[model samples]
Target: MEKITPKVDIAFKKIFGVEENKDLLIDLINATVAPEDQVVEVTILNPYNPKSFSNDKLSILDIKAVGQTGKRFNIEIQITDESDYDKRALYYWAKLYTEQLKVSQNYATLNKAIGIHILNFISITDSKKYHNVFHITEKESGLPYFTDLELHTIELSKFSKD
Candidate 1:
């Protein structure tokens, strides 16, 4: 019998996007995100649904969760290379961050938004590292401008079985 890979979008969602498997998702998030911001618990905002598979192609299978610390995480697995993948990730992160605030809500009410992109192909070809974290910072001062927005890319192609 052939084993199905969790790297596939649907399989990934079924494994990590359900309420019962929240522990797995938390563990994954803790391992992927910065150690300082590690979360012990998380609430799946969009749990998996078997009925949605028929319309899967028309929608994103990303997992959305909120940590105990109030931080939001968007985890996605991408197998194919899309030219606008980077921009789309940023846009989703920004949307999630801004959407936290209501019409009369203050800007301070917004929580940190983190995006984790698991890619089957190399995104940053120049680097040998499989994992990369991105943040907004001042170019001249090398100081972080905004720490609320974080993006992580994990290239599966760089992983070794050993």
Candidate 2:
């Protein structure tokens, strides 16, 4: 049998975005977040359904989910290396974070948005680690200034199967 590698968006969505495999998704979320911020449950907002990808134009298979708490999680897997991937991840985070505010809803009511990007190619050359987390911070103090927006990149190419 040919194994479906997560480098392909369909396989990643099938494994992590579907409702039936939510436990797996929760585990991933928990691993991504801090220990104190770990979630016990996760609700897949956009579950992977084969019918959902029937059209060629609808090929962007990104996963959207909510934690037991109010945090919103956006996950996507990219096979090719895009030099502008950082900007793309930030754009996704902003989109998800802004979408949480409904009509007449308070700005404080917006939930924390987290974007997880799994790439088959390397983007961060400075870091040897496969996983790297980024947050808005003061350049001088190097302290986080924004906690609501968080982005994580998992470079599959940097990871060794061993």
Candidate 3:
């Protein structure tokens, strides 16, 4: 057996390096979330297959994450901006949320589902914010419609050097 000691760097990219630490994703999940119910239950969504999506689809380079605590997280590094990105994100977000409801499951049984996008290219929107979070909300009263479904996106292009 061999033991290896590595140097440390001060950056989120260092902690969550993309090329390696694929499995460490689970660790990130474990750290970011804490559930009130059973902590024994945990699952990591892996959508790395090019064929997992449609035949000609660009394919998901990797997955964000979903937790048993009804929390979802997505961390992606994208270099290009595709058309209808807003719709695309929504489509995937809905897919993650609805996929949980099987043949005989109630709505309450559904856990929190989230999608996170790390875009390397500038988004079409004019907003200068670095991050965005989406949640169900009422139209009139402006109250959260539900806390179970969540979406988060981080724009790396806007990341500044201060």
- Name the candidate that leads on TM-score: 1
Model 2 weakest lDDT span, ten residues long = 49-58
Candidate 3: clashing pairs of residues: 70-112, 74-116
Query: Mind giving the per-residue lDDT tens digits that candidate 3 earns over 48-105?
Result: 4233446644434245455556555554555577877777777667666666677888
Residue 21 in model 3: shift from native, Å?
Answer: 2.7
**TM match of model 3 to true structure:** 0.64
Provide the global lDDT of candidate 2 against the true structure.
0.80
- Provide TM-scores for the models: 0.88, 0.86, 0.64
What lDDT tens digits, residue by residue, belong to model 2 across residues 1-162?
997786687888888888899899888888777786678888777433223245622223389888877898888889888779888788677767776776898898887888888888889999999999988899999898788988999898899887
On lDDT, the stronger of 1 and 3 is 1
lDDT of 2 at 103: 84
**Model 1 lDDT per residue over 1-162, tens place:** 988999887889989998889899999999898787799999888533233257542334389888998899999999998988898788768766765776888888888999999999888888888999999999999799798989999999998887
| Clashes per candidate (backbone, < 3 Å) | 0, 0, 2
Give lDDT per model, in order.
0.84, 0.80, 0.57
Model 1: CA > 4 A from native: 47-61
